[model samples]
Target chain A: MKAVVTVTGTDRKGIIAQVSAFLSEKNINILDISQTIMRDRFAMIMVVDASECTEDLASLASSAAEMGKDIGMSVRVQHEDIFQAMHRV
Target chain B: MFNSTEVIETIDMIEKEHLDIRTVTMGISLLPCVRESAEQTAQAVYERVVRSAERLVPTVGQLSREYGIPIVNKRVSVTPVSLVTAAFPEQSPLVARALDRAADALGIDFLGGYSALVHKATADYEQKFLATIPEALAVTQKLCASVNVGSSRSGINMDAVRQMGGIVKQTAESTQGGMGCARLVAFCNAVEDNPFMAGAFHGVGEADRVINVGVSGPGVVQHALSFAPEADLTEAAEIIKRTAFKITRAGQLVAKEAARRLGVPFGVVDLSLAPTPARGDSVAHILEELGLEVVGGHGTTAALAMLNDAVKKGGVMASSRVGGLSGAFIPVSEDIGMIEAAERGAVTIDKLEAMTCVCSVGLDMIALPGDTPASTISAILADEAAIGMVNNKTTAVRVIPAPGKKVGDTVDFGGLLGRAPVMPVHCGSAEKFISRGGILPAPIHSFKN
Candidate 1:
């Protein structure tokens, strides 16, 4: 039960804070976090352990998406297996 | 471990490129459902399908949500109705209706296996069953029917082909603007475990209940090609194979999960790059993306041959179970790019027939003028079947002769079946040839013992 969350938008203050707050609220643990802002475009990727999350993965995804919408960023949460299967043997 | 770029790539494929599991088909054997009376058999068919496929939609929804990948269709394919109704004959439509009702009850969009395998000859009951297809399909919203008029081993059944030509027209004439014609397929070398429709059927050899998956990612492959537009054909082939691997792996995951949750034995992952009506999700567009000015240009078949081979080469290793029509589909009405190509006269029936020689299937979802004769349709089937038989592959025809419509007009089925512009058929007649009904003997190479 792991998921990958991606956030992309124009750089703004507290984008990570907002996203982290939503994840923590769902009891999802942050396993890894990477973020960078290049020429005003902010891109962040987070890997989270969702097995122990209070909410379902789909619900958490929608919550993050809604929060990202409020902050004018595009956000997506997808199962880690899809990426693993695509990129690895 | 996957890097962030790889993660985003997978997400983008699903989100923007319309990557999806085209179908999760549960093949239910209704051999056990046959009763002495057709009415009783129909009832048994209803109960058996409902019992077997009760959780299909809900399970598919759960899996779709869990993986965040769209499962576009949840379907069921039963044992071919001809075998079940071999004794009952005239009352087979009852079984078709019952299956349709079961589909409605299960909330599935379509159900296949209202079919007959008359490649050699037809039984009395099969002949009676064939006559009910137009009525059965026109009456039911989700029932699909297919007839195997030819096979590599047994040769082409010209009698069945001729009958099917009239039946195809009858199917169209029965429905408004020939929409029912969209749901029937005539095939040479039809497979047992196809998960896609309008051609899926649970062959007699299939197990009782098994889950078969058809995965699609035309846009994903097309997007991958866009990254290396200047690459040579070899490099392009490498890129397509890699992309197809990734797509098939995702499909394997979904198929395994869907089967696990539904408690059905996993059958196979059909690695077809099935396209939709959407703009980016088209096989024709993929060919255009590979450097063709249009999908039906001079080098289109070469491009498709590479694509089809690359898809199989990549997909073969991604899953232990793989079957069905696992290649690129260029159904005209179902693809926006193909529809556009046909409209512009860049893709013709002749060109499509040529393309089918290299691809997995043939002559899918094309439209012809309303007045096109039945014999012409039979001729089309004969030609397509010859290619499949000689080449040792599967080929099919699903043409709609739009009633009261002519070339330059359009026929729209809406939703996934999509739209088509009427393309003209050859002016010549094949009446004498088709009327001389007999078996076109199996290809000489078919004897490989």
Candidate 2:
């Protein structure tokens, strides 16, 4: 299933590296990723296709949560349709 | 890496400078759902609105979160209820109730368009709808109402004006002296594409489905003004124009993306400098940036007129569909620059009135001295309504007569509405003129051959 992941929290060192490494290890292909720093908070919206992933959606979410815990942030995984409905237009 | 001081200053300016979007309104016109029966019509209206707006609140919240730009209000403006009211006079109140229910169900802040555009004379259904405005507003929770009684092209509708004068008084009294005024605004030359509430409504000619965006950034404009003090007139104009362009571009981007995601046609982007309680992002600061020590000076009106025009010119070029009252606002209490000007004797009621002649919305967010009689307030509203009627543009009055505030006393309405130092009113004999309370005759152009 195509999934979109949004990561938002305080800006810190190694955030991009940590998140990218995790995604790569899981074999999740990133379709698009955009990030910007607004006022001091860091926000990133990434569209990914997880059809080829070794793990299920639940495991991917759990792993993201673990990564979020390591970096003091919040991570959410949503279906592509929900993401579009919520973020697109 | 950015310097800490620079970051702090930027943040400080945003906090103090008034950095915020005034509104993010979702335009949903309700004409396509018209049906033979009132029940069918209401059902169609409800279903279409629920389906279209079901995701509006969440989408707006997500955008607000994603951008970290505060979106102050999330509102909806649909087709005027009067058009549909013609089908069932007895069932119009139910329609109003249904709209309120939809607004509640969808979590939209307010739903406008319990309206009638009686610029000349009212039809039978129009009169019925107009009579029901007060009850409709009084009963509904989130439904805002407006009446457009005159337009510059059509001239003032003296009959409607006289009726509205009585209606305003009655509506205020019906709400137990509360004015419920926040929920209703009497406008002249009302615009169809406005996304602001208390005065927003979808026009009859709009597409069945469209998404218009009202993007506001008073703080960003105020920041641009910091560079304005030393700049020449041309330079100052360019600076404001460029800043407004960027702000409008951001709105355009959001609207395009939002429409694409929602599977709806993208509508216009309303580029108005809507203000909040914040400090640096004030419409008054933009005026101040134009070399005024304070707003409401001799040049203030001219400066605001230029700024308002320049914003429209730049915004229109940027987007294909630019509508609404797309210009700078000069609400006294809501803008810090204006409040400061009023406090310092740089701004006055009359100057603000004159400024409204050229600005986008008229007589917005003003605070009158408590002792200022109701007659005077009515007179002020009358004068403003006349200007809109003559100009054939949208203008409104949202004045708060603080019970205890005297001239020079500062009253803080807390957030959004902001604070204002009581500005002086000309202590003159408008009393006799206003007390006459007769309809000012409609202008010559009102008669169509």
Candidate 3:
């Protein structure tokens, strides 16, 4: 199943690189990603297919949270359906 | 994949400036579904709307997500229930219930058409529907109701206006202010092509099906203002024209896709920059950034006139089908900057009326002092309606008379209505003028071929 990972919090350098590296390590292919810095906060939404990832979403989410903690960010992983329901039409 | 500056501007506006197509409304004429039994009529109305608008919300939502443009409201406007219910006046309440149920089943945000155009004279059904407005409005959810009691062509219907004054009060009282008169709009010279809620209705002469779009870009205009603060009048006009063109283009694209998906004819695109309570997303702020401390200053009316005209010109050029009251709005409570200006005494009722002469609607979302006589409110509506009728334009009133609010008392309507300080009305009773019950004759231009 595909999932959407949204990372939001304080803006910091190399946060994107760190998150991308973690996803790549687990073989998660990022289908699409968009990021923006509004005022002093940074927000990123990434769509990724989780089937290719050897690690399940729980492991990925835990690792993502650790990565977020390292950079003072908040990371959330939601199924594609849920994301679409909330953000999509 | 689009490299053009205009495309980039459009994309950027939707992404960052909070610019989006506000509503994609399906105008379904409900006149054909009349029946002897109210229940059967209601069932027919429901089936027709469900069949017509079955894919409306889903299609709009899909397109909105795909394009990353937030389509905030998906709505439907039908033939005025007063006229439709006229076939069965005894079932007026049942008709209202039917509309409410139809809207609920379709998942539309608001269904408009509980309306009567009684500027000249009221039919039997119209009068009955008018009497049941408070009950109808209170009982229905997701159904907006409006009444056009007067127009310049028919002049002010003093009796209808008088009755409406009491109806509005009763409606508010019945709803316990939960709806806060938001779902009810009193209009003079109401337009047939209005795509916005609380006044939108599919006219009798309209086709069986049509799709109309209401596009909003207050934030985009505000962003454009930042680019040309010192630009001359011509330059400012060009900037506004260009921005409006891009915004209208977005609406055009959405409308085409929506109509294609729904298998219906694409109707008009209403280019009105309706502002919310969000920061940096107000039309009045755009005026303020254009060198006015407040939006109703000496130069404010001229500036708004230019902006309104330029927007129309640009929008008309972008879309072959442009209708509705396609102009800028300065509704005080809905716009943060306007609310602040009202608090600061920079915007007043008279000044707002002058602005409406150039802008789209009139005296929208304004809060008057509680004790201001109902006659004065009626006169305000009459005067504003006169402006619309004389100029051959659409004008409406959505004023709020907060029961206990006094002059200078700030009332926070919270979200959408924003927070507004009660602005003082011109101290005088318009009772004499409004009480003279006679139809103001139609304007000269109304006698067209």
DockQ of each: 0.64, 0.09, 0.06
Ranking by lDDT: 1, 3, 2
Interface RMSD of each: 1.6, 11.2, 11.8
Look at candidate 1 and tell me the lDDT of residue A22: 82
lDDT (C-alpha) at residue B309 in model 2: 83
Top lDDT hit: 1
Model 3 CA RMSD to the hidden true structure, in angstroms: 6.1
Q: Of the pair 1 and 3, which is ahead by DockQ? A: 1
Docking class of 1: medium
Clashing pairs in 3: B153-B442, B155-B440
Docking class of predicted structure 3: incorrect
lDDT (Cα, tens digit) per residue for candidate 2, span B315-421: 66666678888888777777777877777887778888899899998887666666666566666777888887666667887665655567777767656667777
lDDT of 1 at B216: 96
- Cα lDDT of model 1 by residue, A1-89, tens digit: 99888898888789899988888888889999988764356789998899999888777777778888998999878788777777889
Name the candidate that leads on DockQ: 1
Candidate 2 chain B weakest lDDT stretch, 10 residues: B1-10
Clashing pairs in 1: none
